[model samples]
Target: MPTVSDFIIERIREWGVTRVFGFPGDGIGAFDGALGRAERHDGGLEYIRPTHEEICALMATAHAKFTGEVGVCIATSSPGAFHLLNGLYDAQMDNQPVVAIVGQQGLASVGTFNQQESNLERVFADVAAYVQTITTPEQAEAVIDIAFRTAIARHQPTVVILPHDVQAMDAVTPGAEHWVSRSSVAAASAAITPPTEAIAHAAEIINAGEKVTFLVGAGATGATDEVLEAARLAGAGIITALRGKDVVPSDIPYHTQQLGLLGSLPSLHQIKRCDTIVLLGTNYPYGEFLPATGQARGIQVDIIPEHLGVRYPTELNLWGDVKATLTALIPLLRAKEDLGWQEKIAEEMRGWEREMLAQTEVTFETGANPRKVIHELNQRLPENAIVTADAGTTADWFGHHIRLRRGMRGDLSGRLATMLAAMPYAVAAKFAYSDRTVVCTIGDGAFQMLGMNELITVKKYLDRWENGRFIVVVMHNDDLAQVSWEMRTEDGNPLWEGSQDVQSVDYAGWAELLGFRGIRLHDDASVGAAMDEAFAHDGVTLIDAYVSKNVPPLPPHITVEYAKNTAKALLRGDPSELAVIRDSAAALVTEQVERVKGALHLGGRDDDGPR
Candidate 1:
């Protein structure tokens, strides 16, 4: 007889779920037993086991982001189940569809303080949009159906808890009664668009201004043609939020890079100079970097109603899918004959590109500049490569140096801003598309936290992939670089060793121990060779890149007050003061030289340079 666990496996399969990320525990043994049976008898779900429950959920979220499907993860009750909170929060914050199936203590032990019997519903309430507990075999399929449907339709994480005994019960059919509802595996959604009059009004607002700019986010990922057409009609520059960095190709003349802290100087200048702002599919959350309230005419459109008009004081708000809305709004906009505004933005970007490369060229006595390390790797990224960046100074390099060409994919923890997600994200990408080369760029601090353990996961599955082009780049700086920068740049505080310093590890040595190719990135000269060797290898490779700890990730637009505060913090006996000042001086010199060369257009353009 089929068990409740078997029924669940079949139901999720019917829902088009092909992979499940999980870790085994005593409470979930029944499900494991059933998984074994399904694998032996019928072609069933692909079970991916991570080193821990947290990484399991993280892989599931990454799967959703890369594959555009509902991601599923399983965990045991109590501590194992609780560990999924952080990763679930990561999915929820990023608006990914994930369903977590966790085990609970037996129903007979309910409310009796049994081992690992704490209420999980209360814990998951905040992060999950839907949570349900299965008590009987008859109730299993219905709950699984709703869980997947809700997660996919809402683009939110959902939870399903199965009691120990319930998972082992013999499968039974629900009766034809009112409460005993049976469900199907079908999932459907419609393309949403706003009213015709509202779209016309939004176009009007966007058309009325002389200097217009489009601020796009993740929602605009597939609507590149529409975004470009709209920008062309309005003679506008396009600025992508961090989440939407890959939405449009960087080489587009008026396509300025990301906005805010990790963004480009061109993006900052464009935002400040624009008279009209078209906020589409982005809740960027940085008001200071946007046009001041009432400074620009705002037109916002988003599928989620609550997200509209929150970031800027928008004059027109339309609730619709970005592609459909833009498609409707395009015809209403009158094409502007003068392309001067866009040309100016394109020229500024041309200048910023030189400054970006020059930032990488600076020589540092302490270590290799991280920007240069990232830039070298960026240059080698294949046309179809997938890259993931962790949160830290590495993110600054990823944002500033890496430019996405057509057909390439890249992502990170954009909203939650969590650490230790990059490695798992890369792992999932490799698992989903084994034929594609996957790259993960992370810092040493995150590697020690959890990225190191995920290495074991990669080694375990080395034989499964069709191509073995997985590469992990570790920025080996012995400090929590981003937080350290925040303390000085945001609060004028010196580096606190207790909070910021992390002990150095021989990352490449560890990889060699795991029977994989590992190389130590010793100097600037070897950057290109190391990357070539890693990419050409037929096995997993690790590059332990030595990077400067004191190099600041300067924002695009630096204010005098910000400069004063940073100077004040470093001058107040900060441990890395001398190196920080040295690097800052090198950076300033690079900027000035590049600015002049860009003005003369004498450095000559490299078709290969990041746009």
Candidate 2:
């Protein structure tokens, strides 16, 4: 008879999970022993040990997000299991398939106040689609099967709790052969196609409108070609949610950038003008940016039926795989002949691009401008690069500036909006595709959160990272810049004392101490050289760029209320606040001036503006 640990490992391997991420702990000794045994044998799974459980969880989430496969992570009981919550929540919110295996105390110690004993099933219930604790060896295979099936089928996180003693018990062998087969696992996940009536109804809604817009999301990841074909047939402008930024290349004629808070003016303009909005695989939460309920007829397509019309009221809801639904609906849609709306949106997009270039050209007198750093990085980024960004001002610059090419991949915390995810995402992207170039853009505050220590994990695995180039660009602004901006602009309050401000660290020195190449950049002029140095370095590298904290990330469409709040905040007599407000106002004015110049045909070549 095989041990419970062996049975669990066999089932995971059978499900095509090749790697597991986590740290070691006493509660998981038996599971760790089984992992070692499996690794020693051919065709067995490998273990990726990150420095912290949170990093492990993040790596697993990134792996699933990038590969579209089930990402597996392991952890010990209590605090160790608790550490996985943040990253698991990222996976949950992003709708990625992730399975977390957590070790628990012995069954006999239940409610006995043991040192590492806690109810992990209850703790993970909110974040996981399925959460269960295995009490007996007989239930091992069944529980593991349910967890993997639920995660893959629902595209969400799943949890399996394993008690210490139960993991070492004799496994039930009666149905082991059936449970450990690849076909059995594959059968649990089947493809879904929308019904004929639903497809016809969606096509009818799209054909009735004069101006249609395709709003993409993470659900549209692998359906790019199909989505683009649909856009071409319908003469629709394409706008993506932040999670769907990589669905279509930025250079596409119909592509109008992203929407919502971290969105573009071109996208917002197109959304307002469109008569019919076709939501493809995205449940974009900001319904205000979309056409009002009665203004535009909406048609939503998604794999999950419940997500339909949750964001905006839809006239037709098509439930199925995005690619499959698009394939079926293409034949039913009447090809749009008039290209007037698409052309107009494209022209406005060009003007927006020119305005954006002008902002990138704006320089600070004291420190590096964060937008410029992102622009330079975007220019030098490899075609096959995998870029990840942390939340805050760093994401603000990256989301607005970085132009992801056809073959590139971009990852962020998405709905979770967590900080310190960029570094771990970069590491995991490198781990998943060792030959690709991976770059992570992070803020100074995010770097300090959990990124500072995780560098050691990158250094530890550097020798094994074959043909991969890892570059971390730290935008050191010396404070929680996003929070400060929110306080002044959103709340109409003065900057808080020391609560949101943080002391800057020698990030370059820290990188050097960890046995990686480190480059510190103090001026805007050094950005290109530092980027080159970091990329050329054989191992992991960090480019510590000192950026201006006074620079603000302006919204695409400024409102009267926002302008009033900003004026009141600036009047409170903080020099830095006043400087930021003045600079932002100037930038806005310059952008509007450039737009007006372009409209009057008084500017240079569209692409050869100020930058």
Candidate 3:
């Protein structure tokens, strides 16, 4: 007679969960026996331990996002389950295929107010696409199957809550029959039978327009190639949301700029000039940025109907999978391979690219080009490098400029943008896949959030040094927050603002103190050499790059709302008006100098720096 834990582990294997990432707890220990048996039976299925459950979930998300498989994580009772929420939320928000197994307190304790017990299902309802608590033995297998299907089919995170009592009981035997077959997401028809006649009319308007633009969002991620093909077909320029940046590589010819609050000038300028704007799988947040004069015909393609007409007034809304819709529309549409349109948009893209490059120059002359260092490391590292970023200027810079090639796996804390996740995430990444190089990019501010505790966990893996060699790059910008400038009040009065000058600490010395190798890179030239050494060194190593704190957190885009906020701040800057003005002037001068220097192939500062 097999135990229910055996059945659960069998189901996990059948669902193709090779590695389970999580920290163990008392409630989950009952399944440990089954996990051991499953690992013995299936070579691919193993458990990977992390310092925290959030790291477990985040690591699973990265695995799922890259492999397109259902990433699995298991956590113990209430406290453990709660810890997994952040990573699960990230998975859900990013639409990554992931399934989390949460162990609840025994059913007898559900309402009795026992320790580590609550309605775990309700707690995770919003975080998971499908959430279920298993009290009956008969429902276990089906619940697991549904969880997998929900994650794999809809590309959303799913959760299965298992009470310790139910998990410990004798359940039905598990076998291959319990597994569901994997299926591809359905595609749309080649013949674009317009969802409505308005679609055709809008297409005609776009075909006739002199300047056309495409806004790509998450909806268009799957159809990136198709969308690009359509952009080429329609002779239009293209920009993407932050979510869609991964869809287009930096070298794409007609790629304009990313839009939103962080959007760039090329996208905004083109949006104003275009007579037709085709929204591909994107729901841009700012409707005001969208043309409203009725001169620009708006065509939208999205799988979700509710999103239609929400961001901007849609002249045509075609509901379907992004790739499917594009495939169908491409055949029905006339390819306007207009060289003039491409050239015009390309010119705008070039100008914005230059301006964008110029904005990063301030960090260079301030000395260490942290951005340039990261850029070089990104280029030099293996494509399969696993990079985890902590929130702050580090996360912002990487999100804006880090080029993620096909095999690279990058994970962030979604919009919550929590600090201290990088170290744990990098630890988990190393634990999850020993063959891949796992690197954590964190700011001095953020690195301290989870500081020495993470090192203890890394030390535990000393027996498996090959699998535990984690590389950490601490961007020491020497300010509490690198984006803020020192300020003074109006009439020469001082107002305390910005990160108080961060205390100087030798981060490398700290790492070395913890029995790990530490290297300090204070200049741009040494960054590459230090990282290479760190990567080659066995076990944990830290590369602390001292960067300038004066550089602004230049977003890819800025909106009218942001400008208005700036104006308000300016008007209210009675305490530090002069300093704020000086900071603005300095930023402008840096931008101008870099713009001129870049074109002439002479550089004054290495401004394209990172944290």
Instruction: Find the candidate with the highest lDDT and give its number.
Output: 1
Q: Mind giving the per-residue lDDT tens digits that candidate 2 earns over 1-611? A: 67999989999988998888988887887898888888887646878898899998998999999998889999989988999999999998888889999999999987798989987877998999999998877678778888888888898999998899998999875453544422246535335777898888888888888999999998998999999999988989999888788889988976877886667877887787789999988878887788977889998888877798788878888778999889999999899999988987787778778887888777776588788888888888887888999999988887789888798999899888899999889888888889888999999999999898878888778776776478899998788889888888787777775677778799999999987788999888888888878777767888999988877787787778777777777778654765686667667777778767666653343322331
Instruction: Put down candidate 1 lDDT per residue, 1-611, tens digits, no spaces.
Output: 98999889888888888889999887887988898899888768889998999999999999998888889999999999999998999999888899999999999887899999988889899999999999878788799999998898777899999988999999987888777888888885736889989988887887788999999888776888899888889888999887788888878988888988889877887887789999878889888899988778998888777788898888888888889999998999999988888987898798888799888889898888888999999999887899999999878888899999877888988789899999999999999999999999999999999999998999898888998999999999899999988888888888899999989999999999999989999788888899999988977999999988877787876778778888889888788888888888888778767766775673453322322
TM-score of 1: 0.96
Q: Give one digit per residue, the lDDT tens place, for model 3 in 1-611.
A: 66677777777777767777878887887776567766677653667776678777877876775455678898998889998998888777666789898888888889888898887878988888899887777677777777887786566799988787787888764444544333322322233334646456656767787788888876565566787787887888888765566666556767864664346655666786788888876656667678866868788877655667787766777766778667666765678856676776676567555665555443445557666667656656665677877776776666555655545566666555666777766766676677777888888877765545677677776565455567888888666553342132112223334444557789988888888998988776786788778777767888888875545455444335544555455575534345445545666676556455544543232223210
Which stretches of candidate 2 lie above 4 Å from their native place?
A: 175-183, 601-611
Clashes of each: 0, 0, 15
Which candidate's TM-score is highest? Answer: 1
Q: Which stretches of candidate 1 lie over 4 Å from their true place?
A: 596-611
Among residues 3 or more apart in sequence or in different chains, the pairs in candidate 1 whose N, CA or C atoms overlap within 3 Å are none
TM-score of each: 0.96, 0.95, 0.80
C-alpha-based local distance difference test score of model 3: 0.69
For candidate 2, the lDDT comes to 0.84
- Worst lDDT run of 10 residues, candidate 1, spans 602-611
